[model samples]
Target chain A: MKLLQLAVAVLLVAVLGGSPLSAGARTWQIDPAHTNFYFTVDHIYSKVRGHFNTYSGAINFDPQRLGESSFSFKIATDSIDTNLAKRDKHLQSADFFDAGSFPEMTFASTKVVDAGQGRYDVHGTFTVKGVAYDLVLPLTFAGVKEHPAMKGKEVAGFNGTLVLDRLAYKIGDGKLYKLGVVGKDVEVLVTIEALADK
Target chain B: MKRTLLQIFFLGIGALVVAGGCALPFLYPTQTLWYKTGWEKAVLQTGHLFGVFAFLALVLQLLFGSRGALLERAFGVSLVMRLHRANGQILPLLVLCHMALVLLPEGLANLPLGLTFWPEMVGGAALLAIVVQVVAAQVRQRFSLDYRRWRSGHRWLGYTVLLLAAVHVLFVADSFASGLPRLALLLLVGMMALRLVYRMVSSRR
Candidate 1:
């Protein structure tokens, strides 16, 4: 009877561990209307700015256990808008995003480390045009609040910036690589406002 | 007195072209004002101004190329020819400045393969034509080529360069999108066409 009771206790522990309710953090879906992903690059003389219009992401977080939080995001590559119709078309071509073959860019965080003062270093794998690279995004949590429009719903806000090398990702090749008409480093700024699931 | 008037006329046109190119940023607010450095803006602006001046020099060369009486009345044949020769040497340098100002900022590693677009192809052809004209002039005596043959080749190449230049200017619509500058370009092109046609008809006679 003692051995049977011990086995039952072990089985109960395993069941509880595998349950989603036991997870430390809540899942929050990024609100598209409130989230913006902007990128800027030097265009020989001045900085050219553009933003991605379509993207979605989910953040799993618990402020008390920051290390256990993770984020996964996917961006539709073709939704890039830069004000100029012709230039936007060129950016979508193989010379830049190559949106046909690689319609989406993605990031999935493997680890999140607290860096004091509400800052975090999110280590993730960023995949672009089928090329995946390890990148660390320095993020800051602004605050969490009750949704103003939806009662009983919680919302969280975070912002971060990431710098990427175009050549490192093979975004530009051949003439573009040698011309360097566009700057090598591209700066990406992300502002995320996510809504917690009820 | 007529020669002085002709000089003033040409200088005025040259000033107009350069001023138009310079004023492009103001007429169209499309260009971004936020630059990392003032040098970048200066390079791009100077490059465009130099491009217009270079093209104007080319047009002057074409206009004064022949020793026709009508042109001689406005500016003596000898004076016209002298100005043409002077521009021939100076035009290449202006082109070099324009290219350097625009391209150097991009760095050396970004040399794409070869001419990929229509404007680029025409611009490349114009540059090549100028180089060939200079090289052929230098080597004609060495190669023992007939003077008439060399002159004919030179004239044909100059015309080709002029034609290619027109296409290059028109295709580059960033600064000349729509305004007085664009109107001026079209007027200049129309005047060039009339002059060329008149020259051809008179030469045939």
Candidate 2:
């Protein structure tokens, strides 16, 4: 009985002490050159798509303990590109992202829930035009592997989709709001490729 | 009688123009998702609206000289001519404003005034057509050209502007990809084509 009790106590101590330290979360920096953050919005009857040209982010991930992982991203509002120079300038102005006043739109994840099959529900605070909102971005892990170009380095890729309401951000208020010409919903698609630090 | 009709007609069109301009933004609230700022979208959209209005006015002037003149019976040829002159003078200013507002927002250096890509090429060609027409109209009298010859040249230039403008709008207009805007554009172009055909048949007769 004494031997059995000692074994049980040892197992309990090992389980409790090992679980937290075994998280093994690894940090990776976003490879901006390979990352794409694009969005689509309803315009009249069709959806118009565009991309942000500049962004940076970091991910702290643990495949085994996925719930403890975290992510943070920052995008330069002025880097908006829709293949139109004039349109981009207008977007950077006070009416849209207000790139002058709020140069960067950021997202920092608070909770992550692994939903099997390499999928995760990442809840974060997304700030744009100085307005912060709780947003849930559904992310899928593409994979992690040895990079061909970067010697002795590993890369991890993730894709996420989020739908946002423009009106919620007060993006097009006043007459434009009443006009209803611009669609209220904006869909964001994020492709992140990160390089693991040695 | 002619003066009263002319005044009333002008007053009615004036009201329509003012109301249309003010109500336009409210009617089409869905701006392109590509734009970051609402004001930017509004400015770009306003530029497009001005171009569309100018095109309509120019088309009306084109139809005025036809056999089945819509305004001649009601407003008299003199009043129609006056309206045509007004449109001719005002159109260049409208075109100037449209081009400036449309291109200047992108920054002067980045203006897509090139012949490489189709959209930019078509827009560039349209601007060129407008410039040619304006220059020709301004200098035609000084060149001592015969009235018939000058009128023929003027008609051809007008046709060029219409064709290029149509191409530019079809290619670049944001809401043109579907539904109402496309349908309206098709109807307007079709009517214009039918009038051109009728004018040709009558001239031959």
- Which candidate gets the maximum DockQ versus the true structure? 1
For candidate 2 chain A, the 10 contiguous residues with the lowest summed lDDT are A172-181
**lDDT tens readout by residue for model 2, B26-143:** 5543344344245555676677667767767667657654424546766678877777766777777777777776655454544454442466567667667767766776787678
User: TM-score of the candidate numbered 1?
Assistant: 0.53
Off by over 4 Å in 1: A1-198, B1-36, B111-118, B141-144
Residue-level lDDT of model 1, residues A2-121, one tens digit each, is 999999999988998776657767788888999989999887778999998888887998777666799899998878888865465467766678876798999999999888899888
List model 2 lDDT by residue over A65-121, tens digit each.
666789888999888998875466666666667676788999999988888899988
- What residue runs in model 2 are displaced by over 4 Å at the alpha carbon? A1-34, A38-51, A54-90, A99-145, A148-191, A194-198, B1-52, B65-82, B96-128, B146-150, B167-184, B201-205
lDDT of each: 0.75, 0.73
Q: Give the number of the best model, judged by lDDT.
A: 1
Clash count for each candidate, listed in order shown = 6, 15
Tell me which residue pairs clash in candidate 1. A175-B112, A178-B109, A178-B110, A178-B111, A179-B110, A179-B111
